[model samples]
Target: MSLPTVRTVADLRAQVAAWRGQGLRVALVPTMGALHDGHLTLVRRGRALADKVVASVFVNPTQFGPSEDFARYPRDEGGDAAKLASAGCDLLFAPDVSVMYPDGFATSIDVGPVTRRWEGAFRPGHFNGVATVVTKLLLQGLPDVALFGEKDYQQLQTIRRLVRDLDIPVSIEGVPTVREADGLALSSRNAYLTAEQRAVAASLNRVLRDVVERVRAEPGTVADAVAAGERALLAAGFDAVDYLAVVDVASLEPLERLDGPARVVCTARLGKTRLLDNFPV
Candidate 1:
């Protein structure tokens, strides 16, 4: 039998705590309410790792800047619930923003230096919001494990670091990014792309792939390789290139030279939407 979903911090915890009393290991898939295959993969991973699953569908307004597309971010609660139910999600916590931030919910988690790099520097206050909401969800869900896909690899890194630093009790799982047949990383923002832009969105991943390949084959300086990637995006139709840098895979520090276990990370704006993709080198 499928488990029923519950909303709110109190009711949701009551249900999961009851399951835990019966020795059930629970896992969670936290999302912003767009139930794509990438998200389903996280849910499936949660199901495989634990007896019960919780998928939180909150778009998170704080994570969006005033200039960003917060108000226009598509939200389909009925459809999201149906998809989560069909994807074998045991519980869906679709919290109302009012319920989440009711009055003075100002406490936030800050990662200091690590959060200040890349995505953070590009979009101020973004990771602080992510860190806060995720912490809140983890506390509410109290799952034995949590699944986050590799598509948002940097966010994955940030979550992992936060968990370690704060001694959060959940194991963070990093699953592979599910992509389109043409190699575009799956994302809700893909919905914002026009047909013309959709054809080039995959260029994000393609450029990252090329950079990785070049780093491996030609053995150029890391700087040279990342510059080549930025050039690739401009040629492929990105309106603006935000950043394309090679950094240490483990530390995430910018690699000033050819080195070991580096990741080529990029952020670009297509039309009004900002996209990020990375590949291991």
Candidate 2:
């Protein structure tokens, strides 16, 4: 059966209000559609956390740069709804851009420092889009808990900080990243990869894992390990290495050595698709 979907905030609130009246807890999973196992995993986690699960499918134009693939970003609401139903999602808040931003929407949320490096630096104004929309979603649904995938570790941390800083009432939880058997972190954008590029993309995880192993063996050689990881990506057929470094997991600051909890995060481009993957050390 197809899941119930709400487009406007009024309808969404009405439905959620009905759920609340029944004393049922709600969990939310936000996505840009083009459903995959990774996204479904989040929905499933929501099922486990709350009595009702709401998944939002909005491409979020603000998060995309002028040169970014906003125009071509994959979206399939019918397909996404079917998948969500199978995954046990209770509601689908698939709002259109107008419904979300309206004609006079002017605000953008900017979570400081956390939005200053890595994905933030490479894609300026990206997290502002994320912060704004996610805040709107959380407020709109007022869910008891919100679930996010840890595949985008930096994003998960950024959201966590924003919720804490803004004093949002919902609990923010992160589900572990789901990966392909070959180790490629699944992403909606992975649909853009050509067959040859797909094969090369799997190496991203393998390389990050290797970097983590090397750093674990010799913490002082962090710089050398990351540099070699970038070189390895380039030699493995990736066109460009955007940024590859070890960052403190919580603060996301670049770490000189792995004296504390750290993550080896990287972003490399194969043709036009930018692949992101991280490993812990």
Candidate 3:
């Protein structure tokens, strides 16, 4: 059976209100369509936490830069709705660009510091788009909990901070990064990889894992280890390394030495597809 979809804010709120009347707690899993196992895991997490799970499939335009793949971002709402139904999602909110941002839409949520490095550095105004949409989603559904994937660690942190600082009455849960058996973090963009590129993509997780082990074995050589990790990505057929540094898991500040809890994060490109992954240290 296909999941019910709401196209407008009014319909979505009505559905949410009906759910709330029955004392059902709502959990939200927002996405840019192109459903994958990683996304389904989030919906399952939502189901585990709340009585009703709502998944939004909007390829947010503002989040994508001019050169980014907003036009090419894979989308299949019929297939996605079917997948969400099987994953136990209660409703699918697939709003169009106009429905989300009308002719006179002029508001944006600005988050500080957390949006300063990694993805924020490379993709300007990305977090602003994220923060605004997330705020809208939280308000639109007033969900009891919101689920986000740890694969986008920085994004997860940013949302956590956004809700806390704004005093949003919703719990933000970070589901662990779901990976393939060989350790390649599943991503919608993974569909862009060619047969050879797909083979090379698994090495991304391997390099990060090696860096984590190296940091554990000898924290003093973190800088050298990061440099070597970059080299390994290039050697493994990645075209370029954006940033490969160990940083505090909380503050996201660069850690010259791993004296405390940290994460090894990186973004590398193969052709036009950029893959981001991180591991705890």
Candidate 4:
């Protein structure tokens, strides 16, 4: 069945109310379109967890940095709707900037600390935009649960913190990363890679994997392992390495040694595309 689409908040709430009237549980999966297996995996998880699933497809302008690819960000609403429906999503909340922001929309949520490093350190205001829109989606849908992909690990944590701090009354679920056969994490931005760049894209995961193994083998060598991973990316044809960190999983603070749960996360540039990936350490 074709998925029903709603662009306005009123229409979205009406549909959700109908679902609630039936006493059915609802889950939400928010996205910026250019849907991939990574996005569909979230929808499938939502379906398994709840009776109805709503996926939002808005390419949030506030989330993109001034230098980042806001205009160039990939979008395919028709294709995304098809994929979401096939994955058992019941509705699509695809809103334009005006609908989401409206006129004189001045408020935004500031999710501090957890958003202050890594992706946050590099992309200013990125997580604030993420937190704001996520807050809106959860409030608007008022779903029993909301699903997010762990490919953006920091993002997942940020949303979790936001929900808890605000008492948003929705459960947040994180689905694992989906990857290509070459070990490259599936991302909408992967479309920007040429054949050669695509080949090199696999190195992001490889370097992180090596770091994880090194950290496990020699726990005191976190700095050395991270530095080596950065060097490995440069030697593997990446244009730049932003960061390769072994950070505490909950706090997102840089770890000198892995005494507790931590993750090896990295971001590197391949041509114009910046890739992010992480592995448990």
lDDT per residue for candidate 3 within 253-278, as digits (tens), equals 89999799999999999999999999
* Shift of residue 230 alpha carbon in model 2, Å: 1.0
Worst 10 residues of 4 by lDDT: 74-83
Residues 1-281, candidate 4, lDDT per residue (tens digit)? 68899999999999999999999999999999999999999999998999999999999999999999999898788888888889988999998899999899998899889999999999999999999999998888899999999899999999999999999999999998999987999999999999999999998898899999999999999999999999999999999998889999977999999799999888899877889999888
Query: Per-residue alpha-carbon lDDT of model 1 for 78-134, expressed as tens digits?
Result: 888888788789888888999789997879888767677888888899999999999
By descending lDDT, how would the candidates be arranged? Answer: 3, 2, 4, 1
Worst 10 residues of 1 by lDDT: 1-10
Q: Give lDDT tens digits, candidate 2, residues 1-281.
A: 87999999999999999999999999999999998999999998998889999999999999999999999999889999999999999999998899898899999889999889999999999999999999999999999999988888889999999999999999999888899999999999999999999999999999999999999999999999999998899999899999999999888999888899999888999888999988778
Model 3 Cα shift for residue 214 (angstroms): 0.5
Clashes of each: 0, 0, 0, 0
lDDT measured at residue 235 in model 3 versus the true structure, 0 to 100: 98
Could you tell which candidate, 1 or 4, scores higher by TM-score? Answer: 4
Question: For every model shown, what is its TM-score relative to the native structure?
Answer: 0.96, 0.98, 0.98, 0.98
Candidate 3's TM-score: 0.98
Candidate 2 clash pair list: none
Candidate 1 Cα outliers beyond 4 Å, as residue runs: 1-3, 218-220
Model 4: lDDT to the true structure: 0.93
